[model samples]
Target: MFKLCRLKYYLRNKERLIILQPLTSSLDEAFQRYSSSAADKDFLHRSILPTDHFQASLPRLPIPELEDTLKKYLECQRQILTDDEYDQTVDIVNKFKVTEGLDLQKRLIAKDKRNKHTSYIAKPWFDMYLKSRLPIVLNNNPFMYFRDDPRPEYQNQLLRSTNMIVSSLKFMKTLRANILEPDIYHLNPAKSDNMRFRKIMRMIPTPFVFYGAYMFKTLPLDMSQHKNMFNSTRIPRPGKDELVVNKEGRHLLVMRNGNFYVFDVLDASGNILEPGVIMASLHQIMQDQSPPNTEPVAVFTAEDRDVWASYREKLISLGNEETLKLIDSSIFALCFEDNKPTDPNAITRMFLHGEAGRIWFDKSLSLIMSAGGNTCVNFEHSWGDGVAVLRYFNEVFEDSTKKSVVHPSTSVQTDAASVQRLEFKLDQEMKENLQQSVKKFNSTIQSLDVHHLEYYKYTKSYVKKSGMSPDSLMQLAIQLAYYRQCKQTVATYESCSTAAFKHGRTETIRSATAETKRACTLFVDNHPAVSVEELKKAMMACSKKHGSLTRNAAMGKGFDRHLFGLKILAEEEDGRLPEMFTDSNYQKINHIILSTSTVSSPAILIGGFAPVTPNGYGVGYSTEDSRIGFNVTSYPPSTNAPNFIECVTKALDDMYEVLEGRHPAKSI
Candidate 1:
């Protein structure tokens, strides 16, 4: 039964191709090397089949029709394959198959762990809801609607990209609570028997569950005090000691008794809290107090703004500590709406309209300078990715404005008439299926480490040989790979990458989503398949292609990766990015390059949105060889298509033609 099921999965969904070449000495070496490489990795090991004794498998369908066919198959099988079956197919092909190399395995494993941790606490109904609703949302492509009005004047107006993100997060939060009704549990790590049993069970199929209770250690308020903490991990830990002083004037520690843990000030309640809940609650608090209003309740005229900058600088130059402190606190006050303006230089007012209203200012420049000015914006958390936080921020702003302030009496009447909901029970089969899905997810993760080191080295070397920037090379390779697999002739395959810009003035916040996250994706066109030699020559030409550098140029640099990772660590420590960049009283620091590389992978890398990463929390991946990698610092997500793989394969078939520099007619 298992073999039959596996066969059906491969025949229906897998992308199989035959490589026919003249028998040569190098051919044997190539096959041996490739086979050995595949054998060492989990994904490739499953998908690859040695046919020394038989003819190679025939190409089942043209490349271009492949993606569409797969999509159709998935859609049609939606009813037949429960989440478990779908997951099983994914596992068998991605993990058990012999095609995914070692690097692919590592990526898959990382994703699997993440997904499992997330699922452990996730409601099955919620996962189902996401599966059902997400496809609808993607198919509708509501985001494309924002692109329709690209006028500069409307850039910051109406529902912008950030606004969409915020709306989505808010909706998800509400849906999770109202519809999913997730059970609250904690991991009790102190009990060795329980912990061991739980770990073992995690390897087996199980329903969505999280560690019921756990307590991890905490960091001190001073960086000097926590030298021992740095020993726990090689990657930089956020300088939590410094961060605590900036936000809450104390050190915060992560307490974990088992899997359940909490990050809080020492001696505080140690209940495990949901990161999503914290984000939603924080957003609600900010939005409710400061509803979206067109009129700037706080503004500065051109002259007053100049004078303020001058005065602040003078005080700082003269080492006037008291005045500097006052200025710093005042800026925070402006950002947080904690104080009223005294001796107002420019007229700043707050305005509120009915739901679906706009926040506008009569003063053109002043309004433009504020958040809703020339650029649309959204906040992000230090720990979270920019995209996710921006989504939450936008949602809060939109939801806050949409709420109509009804009289207390009306509210009471509505509540009194509301009906209590009943809990629906899942049958035994349904429960078993949910458990199996989770197990399959774990199995995929286990396979990721099969060839981690080798795959990483090969990929790194391949990127270098391509002679394109890291982002661009990755994008090109992905495109080529996808083209080979799908064999489609689309007009263009768009690739995009994002850079982060920070202009908001909050030093320390509970989450990274507190600061604004903005980014853009760049697109390029790919030429159709040609012989190997020709394609290589073209690739060389493409790599040499260059244009004047813009801010986008800075983002394309590999340095951005380090900076992005640093930002998260910093935020996690200090509750936000570096304060030096956000000191409104001195000079409002804005814009930092997060991820600069081009979107070069065939697979899409959706980043800028933060992942929910609590200690030990994990996410799952659908494909063994195909996994999404996020550069958290980038503004918008980027994608690389699988066209390059196809190009490489085609090159192998017509090496002599390519060597002669014969160009093929445009087919894709």
Candidate 2:
């Protein structure tokens, strides 16, 4: 016992020394100094901002050392490439690490020193997303479906619509006043501020080369002008601070019968419209059904990037200037659907690929509230990831359902006409283009399929009992399933949130690690040579490694985003992309075959997408104490989503049986 104690003591001291050695080494001098700075310490302790006053106080996303990035990149490449390709890629990476990489690093560091952007990676990230040719709906945008509202009164369409508008207006007021607490990493005040949340909240979806926001005033709902509720009498004049302070740009576009009408959600005195008035206005919208004189304009957003760009130019040439401004300046959109969904999955499916005319896939976000009070949000991933939209949904739900938030009337002029309809001037050729877009969009949505699985026999608690990280276990289960089905491990992207740093989005947590591969291989083989105990040990080690990697990513020390920033900087400075970045092996490995993220929420029923790449699966899961639910999506006729989920179900049950020495668990 004494010898064992001494051995443990030696091991503990050795581990401590290993951790401390990095601080003294020249390799990590910048990180050490930054970590020790009193100012940074103080900054971390400061309260989350009510405004952008403390924006500069947050730390910038750090650029990882080039050699380190190359090492990780090469390791990931090995999982996806042939031996010959791997060797060629290794040679390219070696050359890069010694020469061009050094130059790129210098340029990136210099840019970091000179620029004051919220994130060094933001510009390039945004540019790549906007320029991509993929259609928005399932390809690039994410959807979150909320569970059914418990209150029966919310089932009333008019009341539901009115209350939602009120709740949204309240949310905007809190936003403009900067009272909505910025989501800190783990709710830690010292961690990075999620300021990107504010940007997407009031963002407008435009059909131009770029997206922009509008300036407008919120008016009380009018019952007298039912027919004109979809019409506007006044377009608020731009103020001196229209570029920034016109926080009133919270203009919401309402979609009904494949048509759109814009309206400000707040009254002139910054008050929520009375529920009765809002109800009447919604009633008016439901009553009016106008036939199309031309093609639906929003369908153009679903076209290829270049195709849409060209059409947008044509649109501007034949533009109604007022309509263009209305589309540009609106903060966000709200779609009131006439259809009702019976289940959470149904609502999610509707939001992801709703009927074309009633949906606007180009906007930063569109809040779709069904007549039955079922709700979901479709958001553009180019602006941000799921976290930002999740925060918005949380706020709205909390204000509307969780609390009895009240707004008193100030007795301002109540009759001001605020809502307006956008009139488009389309020629015959443009109408033809719209028809083609609709066909393409429909084809894409039809090819997509979803399989919602609820594995109830085992959950997070069972995994915890086995002394394994639930997330790591889930990831391993997915890898095993894919390998069993496809007979190989390809590139996998598990979103590691970097909200711990200011303006950070996500880093790719390379889920296909060596240990995971080994464990998966053993499980698939059910090798008698490999004991269950040995497999458990391997899984636990993999889980620990994954946790460490995720924490590093949260600290802005991940590979993908950092390397992305460096590559962009190199292009700007040298007038060409580095050879290593252009390598075919590099391109092949980065094609994510599995895109997965988990958003564990009681209020959120499911969150997910259609895979970003053609032959991949998009997996969104929620692992609760009692059950594990998976929302899996893929493009069928090329990739089989049902087969993937079948493998997943088997893998999950098999894993549980192996770990717990029990009969296989059941899954649905």
> Whose TM-score is greatest here?
2
- Candidate 1's displacement at residue 29, Å, is 61
lDDT of each: 0.24, 0.65
Task: Assess candidate 1 and give its TM-score to the true structure.
Answer: 0.21
- How far in Å is the alpha carbon of 48 misplaced in model 2? 9.8
lDDT of 2 by residue, 441-473 (tens): 788777778888889878888888888888888
Highest-scoring model, lDDT: 2
- Write model 1 residue lDDT over 1-668, tens digit each, in one string: 45334444433442331122223334545645764672322111211111110111111111112223223223323322447655544443333223322333344334435553221112221122222211111111111001112334332322222232233323432322222111111233354333233332222211111111111111001011111111111111122101111222111111011000111211132221222333332233233433333221111111122332343344345454442232221101112122222211110111110011111111110011123422222111122222332333333334423421221122122212211111113345433443453344334222221000001222444444445433333333333333344332111112111211111111110000100000000011243443455455555443343211122222222222222223333444447544322333112011211111222222112211111111100111111133323221111123221233234333222322333455533332
User: In each prediction, how many residue pairs overlap at the backbone (N, C-alpha, C within less than 3 A)?
Assistant: 100, 4
